[model samples]
Target: MNDKSKSVKFFEQLSWGIWIWSFIALLCVSIYLSVWAPLGNIAALLVTGISFAGFYSLSIKMRTTTKIEGQMLISNKAKIDLKFIKSATALDAEGFKRLAGVDADPAAFLAINFWSKTGVKVELKDKKDPTPYWLISSKDPKRLVKALVKAQK
Candidate 1:
């Protein structure tokens, strides 16, 4: 859904697995109730449809989006200007685990999801800002890092 002008360099949605699992659980419950109460298949289908709509709304509330708009590094939780960033490191699954777990900074801005194992760690240059870095989850860490680096320049 991006235009040819390419103002946005990266975009990803986290926790899509929740959408799949929630729908399956709701459908199963609908079928189980149909077996016990003699409700027709049409009624079960209706219940399934209604549950899907509710779950869609809930997933939207839980989902986190990461995107770069112009020179801004943004997520559902927070956004920052690229000018304040010093460097961007693309982390693999293992590097991400270490930084997100054992080496995490208390003052860092975290826009991470457990389901996302690859990401970027953005070090901040602005001394006035208390935050040391930003930890962001991405489906493609390299692409995200590339975007952030380009924006910082």
Candidate 2:
């Protein structure tokens, strides 16, 4: 568990390798279009540059924003309070699949991304809240669970 008075932060982001490879592929396509297609050099460059910039910007914003702050779990799509969290457990790929598929609660909130093969399941304790739990995809599930548990204190 984490120190009761100390705040700990945990974050997850898209793999840089994935981003680089995607950019490379996009570059290749753009170059091919510029050289062979009727769009021409200037138009192709502008289109490709804009497209790449938009994609990269959105990806970075979305990926990097998923983080834990103090006792709050902050993601691009949701913010969760650790006080409302009863327990947190890390899940591997198969476990994630099973829980999300067969054992999923209809009232649970999910902020899952397929790029991550692991996740953390947080059971909610707040009876007043209709949400049963949360399933959040993570690049580092163990660390995330640890952080959540620590924050619980």
* C-alpha TM-scores of all predictions: 0.76, 0.77
The stretch of ten residues in a row with the least summed lDDT in candidate 1 is 1-10
lDDT of 1 by residue, 21-115 (tens): 77668676866587547876777767767766777787678788998887778888588888888899999999999999999999999888867
Q: Which stretches of candidate 2 lie over 4 Å from their true place?
A: 1-6, 15-20, 23-36
Best by lDDT: 1
lDDT of 1: 0.82
Candidate 2, residues 7-125, lDDT tens digits: the string is 44777765445666676677758665875488677777777777677766765655634677777887666887778888889998999998888999988988776566788898889
Residue pairs that clash (backbone atoms under 3 angstroms), model 1: none
Q: In model 1, what is the error at residue 9, expressed in angstroms?
A: 2.5
| Candidate 2 to truth, TM | 0.77
